[model samples]
Target: MSDKRPLLDTSDIESEKDGIMGAKESSLLMTGITYKSTTVAPTVVWYGRQLLVRRKLFVGLLVVFIFSYFLIGPADVLDLDNVDSIVQVHHQSNVLDREVNQKLLLPKGYLVYSNQCRIVDLDPYKREVMRHFKRVSYKPCKQRLPLTQMRYDDHTRRYVLSINSTAFQSYHVKNVLSCCYMGVERVSESNVSYTHCEHFKSKAQISNTTDSVIVKCSTEKGQIYINGHATIPERLQIRQRLKQWKRRDQGRRVPSVLMIGIDSISRVNLIRAMPKTAQYLYDNDWFELAGYNKIDDNTFPNIMALMVGYNLSNAMKYCNPYVSGGLDKCDFVWKLYKKHGYVTSYGEDAVKINTFNYLKKGFKQPPVDYYLRPYLSAAEKLLDGNVVLGLPHCLGFETESEHVYNYALEFARRYRNDSFFGFFWTNTHSHGDISQTSSMDDYLKDYLQRLLAQGTLEHSIVVFFSDHGLRFGPTRSTWSGHLEERLPFLFIWLPPFLRAERPEFVKALRENRNRLTTPYDLHMTLKHILTLSGRTGKLETLDGAKDCPQCQSLLLPVPLNRSCEDVAIEDHWCTCWSYKAINKNSKTMRHLGERVVHYLNDYVTSFRNGSLAHLCQPLTLQGISAAYKARLSDDDPSQTQIYWLTFSTAPNQALYEATVRYNKSSTSEDNVQVTGSVSRLNSYSGEADCMNDFAIKKYCYCHHKSG
Candidate 1:
C-alpha cells in the first residue's frame, strides 16, 4: 500500500487553468449593449424585418438597439414591474389569448422568437425556445439554485456567449450569476449529455465537497468555460465525493417524516385533480388509504385530529384555543417526536387564515423549531413571486402548489440526515378554486421525483395527504359530493428497504386501502414509528404496540367493516352506509320532507339576526330530491327512524338537505328530531345572506334587516 496514488504535474495544471480562464484582462470592459428592465415592443424591426441579413450588419443593428434600450427609454411599452399586475391586465383583456405574434427585431445572427418578442430565425437550423433562465453557477456548499437552462452551440462545442443573444437572463444581474469550472472525464456517455439542459444544471456543485469543480472569479461578462483534467487518483476521489454528495445519509437506519398536506381535496377528487401524483405514488409502491375519513368539517377540526388525535370539539371542551389557551402545551404528535430528539417544523401557505390562526388565537411563540407564519408574513408583505398570500384573500399563482412543494423540498434537502418531522400544508391551490389544482398534478409529481432522485426521501416516510374534499364548489351539492366531503386522500411513502424487509406491514397497509381510516390512524402510525425508535434504535421492529382507542395504524390490520361510531366519526359525517331514494310524494318522503323544512326554519331563527321576518310561516315543500335510509330499529320501523333527505324550503326559496330522525305513525304523530348535520346546497335570494360572512354559514340562513 505504498504510494499507490498518482501525482499531478504542475505544468498540466497551469495549462488547464489558462485554457479555462481563456484571455483574462487586468480590467474588464462592458462594450456590448445591456438592457435593464427594458420594455421592447416586439414589433421593433431592425433592418426592415429582413429574414436574412449580413452578420456584420446584424451585429451593428444590435449595437444601435442596445443604445436605444440603454441610453434612451423603451417607447410605448407597458412596464412589467409587477408581474401579477401585468398578467392580471393581460388576463382581463381578451387579447391575451389572441395569440398575436409580437416581433422585436434585433441585430442577431441567430433568430429567437417568443410571445413577448417574436423573431424570425435566419439560421439554417432553428432551435426550440425555452422559458426559464439559462446557465446557473454555484459556490461550494451553497443552498439549492433555481432551475436553469442555457443555449448551447453543438457545432462549435461551446456555449453561445454573445451578450446580445444570450438567454442567461440571471447573468444580467451580478448577484444571480456565478462562474464555475467542472473538472471532469465523462464516464457514462449519457451523463455527459446536456440535451435535457436541466440535467446539466442539476449537476452543478451544490456542496463544498462535491465532485464537480466550481470557483468564483471576477469577469466583465457572464459566459465562461471550464478547462481541466484530473490524475487517476483525483478522478477516483471525485467519484467518491460525488457519490457521498448525492447521499446525505448513506448508511443511516433512522427514517425521517415529511408530510405535505393539501387542504380541501377528497380521495376521489385527489385522483381527478392530481392524477400524475396519484400515479406516481402508485407506481413507487406508496400506499393509499382510500377510505381515510375526516372526523369533522373544515381545516381546523381535521388538523386538530391529525396533530393531537383530538377533534376540535374535544379540544375546545378541554384546552380551548378560542379562549386563548395556547396550543404550545397541547400534546400534538410533533411534540412526541420533539421529545425524542427530533426537529419538528410546521408550515401553512395561508398563515393569516391558517387552521389554528383563524379559528383560534395562533401560538404566542413558534410551536415547532421552525414555524412558517413569520415567513408567510414576509412573503406576503415583502416578496411577491409565484406564490403570494394577499390581503383579505390569499391570491396566488396557479403554480402556488409548486411553490409550496419547493418549500417542503428545501426543508427535506436541508435536513436530509436529521431525524425530523416536518408538516407543510398548502391551501393556495385547492382552498378556493379547486379547478386550478388540476394543473398541480405534474408539479407534485416532479417534486416527489426530485426528492426521490436527490435521495432526500430514501430515509424518510413521506406523506402526501389532504384535510377534506372541496367544501364550497358546485360539486359539493351532489350525494356523492356529501360522501366525498368526509373522505380525504392519504398517500404514505415508506423507505424501500423497510417495505422490502417487512412485507407483512406493507401488505397490511395495502389491505387497509379500502378499509375505513382517519387522520387519528395517521397519528397512531406516527406514534408507532416514534415509539419503535426507542433506546434500542431499532425502528424496523414495530411489534407489541397497541392501537389507540379510535385509531388504527394502516401498517396493522384494520377491520374492513369498521363502523363510523367505532372510529369516533360523528353520525352525520358517516358515509359508510347504503341508501335508496324514496319518491317525493311517498309517505316516508312527506314525513322526512316536513322534518327537513322545519329544521331549516328552526336553523334560520337560531341565527336571530333579523331574519325572523324572512323565516317561513307556511313552509311549502317544493320537492324531495333524494332520501337515504339511516340506521333504524328493525323491531319497530317507527322506533327512531333516521332519513337523510334533500328538500327545498321557501320565503328564501333556498334548497336545503338534512338527516332527520323521527317516529311517525298512521296518525301522523309530529315527533321529529333534527340531526346536527344540515347542509344548504343552494340559496336563491339575499334574504338570508346576513350570515354569509360566518364560517358556519351552511346552517345560517338569516338576513339582517336594517331599519
Candidate 2:
C-alpha cells in the first residue's frame, strides 16, 4: 500500500523539535508545504494563503466595525440627554385657572388671617392667640431650654435654677409658642399640690427661702428639665414600670436594630463626597440599595412614610407633620417595637428646628425609652451663644455630630444583650445647607468602622441613610440635581448568621441592590423584623409580593419591572422619566401648559373647599422655561412631552412643570388627541413672587413685571 501519511521535512522536524508545532500542526507541511520555527514558511501557498487572507480580512473588518461603532454610535450614547435639553431650552410659560380664596382654615388657636404666610409675625399677635391656648396635660416634654437647668433642692426648699441666657433663647422664650412656666406637686398627693408657675423671662424672680417643701418641679407644658427629673417616689414607680416591662419581654429573641441617618444628602452626592466611605461599607458585607428614593420632597413626610408605613398625604390634608396634631398620636413604628419589649430610642440633633416640632408642638413626654431631645436641649443650653450659630454646636462637650454618634454608639453598646431599636439623625452637619456635609464624611465613616470592628452590630440590623438631596441651591437647577433631590442613600448591613441561614434572602437583596425602593419599603422591612422575635426564632421568608401597592419588605423580591405609580409615588414627585416636551412655542406646547394649569387648579380646588382655595388670580402663561421628551423605558418606543412653564397670577408668578402625552397618530396639522390626561410634575409655589427679586430670578422673569 502507498504511504498516505504526510512526511515532515527537516525544517518541519526542527519546528516540532523547537516545540513550535505539535504533530497535528506539523501536518501542514504536506503537499509542498514547509513550516519553519519562526519565519513565515512556504506552505501550499495557493490554498493556505487564500485561507490566511480570508481570516485576516474577516478580523480586519471586525476591527473597523468596532472602531466605527465606538466613534459614531457612541456620540450621545453616554451623554445625559437631560443635561443637553436643559442647556438648549430657556423659556416656557403656563396658563392656570384663577384660584379664589375662601375662608382660610387655621389650626385651633391660630389667629392669622391667611394660612399662606411663610413666617408668622408674632410681636403683634401674641395677645390675641394666647387666650385660645388651652392647657391639656399630655406627655411630658423632654426638651430642655438653652439656659435653664432645674434641680430640686430639699435643703433650700426650692428648685435651684441655673441658666445662661442668650439672644436666641430670649427670642424663643418670649416670641415663639407658649412661654415657659414652673409648677410643683407633691409626689404622694394628686389633688392638693402646691403649684407656682411663671412665664419664662430673663429677670424672673425665685424665692429661695428656708422652707421645707417636698414637691416635684415641672413645666406647665409638661416638660421636665434636665435637673427636674421626677422625685424619689416617682423614680421608684418608673423603675417598677421598667421591671414590669422587662418581665413582659422575658424569653423573647428579637434582634436589635440601629438606624443612623443624615439629612439632605442624595446618594449621588454621598458617593461623590465620600467615595472611600461608600466603598468601605460595600466591602464590609453591607449592601447598598442604589435605587432607594425619598417618598416626599422634605424630611418630615419622608420620615413619616418610613415610620408609619403610609403615604404622608393620606395621613393629612397637607404634607407638614404639625398640620395634623403633630405626630404625638400617630402610633409610629417605634411604638410597635416598644410594645414588643424592644428598648426604643429616637433622637435628632438640632433642637429649635426639630422636624417633629417644626412650626408645631413637639411630643409631650419621652416618645422613646431614650429620647435625645432633652440631652440635646441640655447641651444647647450649655453651648456658648456665639458658637451656637456655627458648626459643631456643643453636645455635652463634643460637637453636635460627635455627640449624636457617641449617643448611638453607647446605646448600642449598653443594649448589646437586649433587643433594642435606636434611630439617630443629625442635621447639624447637613441640614439646610449641604456645603459642609463633605467634612462629616470622615467622622461618620470612622464611627461606623469602629462599630463594625467592635462587633457592636454583630446581632443587629444596621441602616445608614439620608432623607433627601439639597433643595435650595444653584445645584437644584441642574437636571442631575433635580433627580438627585429624590434619590437618598440607603445601606443596610444584615447579620452574617441571618444571611447565611437564608441564602434566598441574600440573593434577593443582591438582586434588589439596584431596584427601586422607598421609605415605605423600609417600614415594611421593620415590620418583618418585628415578626422575627420569640423563642421559636422562626424567620419567615421576606414578603415576596412583587407589585405591592403600599410597601414591600427588603427581604422580598421587588419586581424588576415596577413603576413609581405602582409604589405609591405621586406623579408630581415621581423621578421615573416618562415625558418629553414639544417645541417651546409650538401650539401643542402652549395647549399642554394651559391644560397643566387648569389641572393644577382643579386638583387644588378638590382639596381646598373654602376661601383658602381661591387665594390667587387665574394663571396666565409668561413663557416656557424648558421642555423634555421622556421615553418610558428602553423597550417602549412611545414618548411623552414635559414642559416647565412660568405662570403669573396677578401679583404672583410660579414655576410649574407638567407632563402631557399625545396620541402617536395625531399630526401637528390635526387637532391632537390626548393619549393620557395631563399630569403636573412639580410646582414651585414661591419661586416667582412679584415682590421678591430673588424668587423672580430663580423661577420667573423680572423683566415681565407688567404681566
Candidate 3:
C-alpha cells in the first residue's frame, strides 16, 4: 500500500538543480528571467526634408492630407469607454485568449494604456516587430532572490519536503510543525546547503530544524515538510469522517460526494494516479472528476470545455489564461444536483482564471446563458442548500496556494454530510513560478502522505486531476505543437457499488492499465458520479461506467435546452435564458470573435478623440475609403508582393497606430476595429534596412531602410 522509492541524494548533483528525474520528464524544469510590468515611452523622431527638389514634387498635398485626417479621425474618437455606449457588449466566443500580461505592464483595468504608446498587440507571426515602446520601464515584483531547487523521491516510509525561501514576505512565512508521520525516520543528509531564503531573509533562525538527515521550520501560517523518506495510508480518512455523520445511515440514496484533483493529470499520469485512487474507492467511494477536459488537444481550454462538451479552439487569441473555462460554451454541472436537492461547496483558491468573470462562477455562454444557483436546478435564483465557499482564484502570481488547500480541508471537515459536494482546487506552485513536475510531484506526494495520515482520505471517492499540463517554457519546440494537450491525469477513487455496474470500465482498467483517456468523456463521467447521469443512469461502479462496446451514445448529453425552441441552433443546446438569443435570432459571437470587435470601438475612440487623427486628415481626407477598407486576409502580408505596393514606410520607426472601422456584412453599422503597432527596435541614424533579417520563424528582424 506504500512506495519504497529510494531517496534522491543531491550531494553529487550540483546546487543549480535541486533534483531532476530521468532526462525524459526533466525537460520541463528550469529557472529563467523574472517578469514585471512597467511604463513605455514614445520614440518619435522627425526627419526634415533636406533638398529643395522635394518641395515642388507634390501639389496641394496639404489639402489632400487635410481631408484624409478628418475621414479617419472620426473612427479614432471612439474607444472602450464608449464601446459600450453604442454597442451591446455581448460575447462572441466566451474564450479569453488575451489575458492581460500584468507582469510586463501595470494594470489600469479594462480601458487604458500608456500615453506615448502606440496601441500594439503582442502578435509574433509576421516576422516583424510587435512591441509598441522603445523605452518602457520595468520594475520587478521583488528584488532578485536566491532560488533553491530540490527534489525528493519518497513513499510509505520517511516523509520529506524541500525548504527554500524567497525575498517576498510570504517566503518568510513557513508552516507550523503541528504534525508528522509517527513512523517517519530521517535517514541521512550529506549535502545540506543554504544561502538565506531570498523572500524570508530577515528571519533570525534561517534553518528552523535541520539534522544530518533532514530540515524543518515553523512559521505562523502552517506546517512545512521537507525532503525525507516516509509512508502514506492505503485509504483516505474521508470515509472514516463520513461515519461520524448521522446522515450516512439516514440516506436511501447517494447524497454526498468529493471531487479530488491531481494537478496536470494526463493520459500518461492518469495511469499512475487513477488505479490507486480507484482501489481506494473500490473499498468505499463517493466522488467525481476533480479536473476534466472536453477536448484532449487544448489544455488551456480544458476547464471551460469540461462543462459543455467541446474545445474553444484557436479562439483564445492574446495569451492563455490559467484554467480558462470561458474559452467555450458550458454550464456548471452542480446545477443538476442542486435541483435534485444537494448542497455544494468549493474549498479552493479564488478561481481568478476567469478574470473577466471569476465571481460569476466563471460563467461561459452555456448553451443557455444561466448561472448555477444555490437552489436546486429546478428553481431559478434559488438556493439548493446552505453552502460554504471561498474566494474564486483570480489565478495568477499571488501565493494563496496553502490557503486554498487548507480551505478545502477545513470545509470538508466542517460539512461532511450525506447531501453535499465539495471541491478543493489548485493551479499555482505548478507552472508560472516553479517549473518542474517531478519537483511538483515531490511536494504533492508528501502532502498527500500527511493528509492521508490525518485520516482525511478514505471511503470517499477521491477525484484528482489538473486543468491541463504545462508547457515547459517558451520554446522553438512549441510551434502549435500538441504537447500541452496530451498529458493530464484523471485519478478517481470509487467505492464497490460504483464500479460493479460499469463492467466495460472495469475491463478497460483491468485490460492494459496503460492506454490513452482524456476528459473527453468528463461531462458524462461527472454526471455519472454525481448520480445525475441524466439518461445515462447512475453507475454502480467503475466496471459499469465503462463504454460498453455496443453502447452508442455512451450517455453523452445533448444541448441543454433542446426542447421547443425552433430557431436554428448548433452543437450543444441549452434551454436557459441566454439561449433566448437562439429564439430571437440574435447575433451570437463565436469564441470571443464578437468580443474582439466589441473592444475595437475602444481603440477607435482613442484614435478619433486624439488630435492625431484630425491633423492627419489630409492624408486620407476621410481615411481609407469604406470601399477600400478591405479585410486582412490570413496570408502573411509582408511575404506578399502586393504588400510592397500597398503601403510604404522604411522598416519601422515611431510606433504607428492606425484605426479603421468596418462592419461585417452580417451586421450592418456594427463597427469592428483592428489596431496595429510596430516595435521601435534600434537607433534610427539615417535609414535602416526595413526588411527583417530572419523570415517565417519568430526570431526575425524587420526595420526601416533610409538611404
Per-model clash counts, in order, read: 5, 30, 127
lDDT by residue for model 3 (403-442), tens: 3554445434434434446555554344331122222343
What lDDT does model 3 reach? 0.29
TM-score, cand. 1 vs. native: 0.58
Q: Candidate 2 or 3, higher TM-score? A: 2
Once model 1 is optimally superposed onto the true structure by TM-score, how far is the C-alpha of residue 542 displaced, in angstroms? 14
RMSD after Cα superposition, model 1:
25.2
CA lDDT scores, all candidates in order: 0.53, 0.52, 0.29
**CA displacement after TM-score superposition, residue 666 of candidate 2 (Å):** 11
lDDT of 1 at 106: 27
Q: Write the per-residue lDDT of candidate 2 for residues 1-707, one digit (tens) a residue.
A: 11111121233245334432332243343333335454455645555787777656656655654554353232112122221111111011121112201222323222121111111111111111111212121121223443444344546434454454552254243322323444333221011233454555433334532111112223445432322221111133333544565576665445789999988887756655554566567556576666686766577778877877556555454333444344556667788777766777777877766667654555655577766665455445533322432444544324576667876886677566667789989887666453456555566678888887767677889989988876655445334455667778888888876776666666666666656778888887887777776522333443322223556788877666566666776544555442333356777666666665555555444533533334334445666655555434444454433333323332334544444455545566323332222222234434334422111122232324445
The digit string of per-residue lDDT tens for model 1 on 129-198 reads 0011011111122122222322234354233212222334433455434444333222221122111111
TM-score, candidate number 3 = 0.35
User: CA shift at 267, candidate 3, in angstroms?
Assistant: 5.6
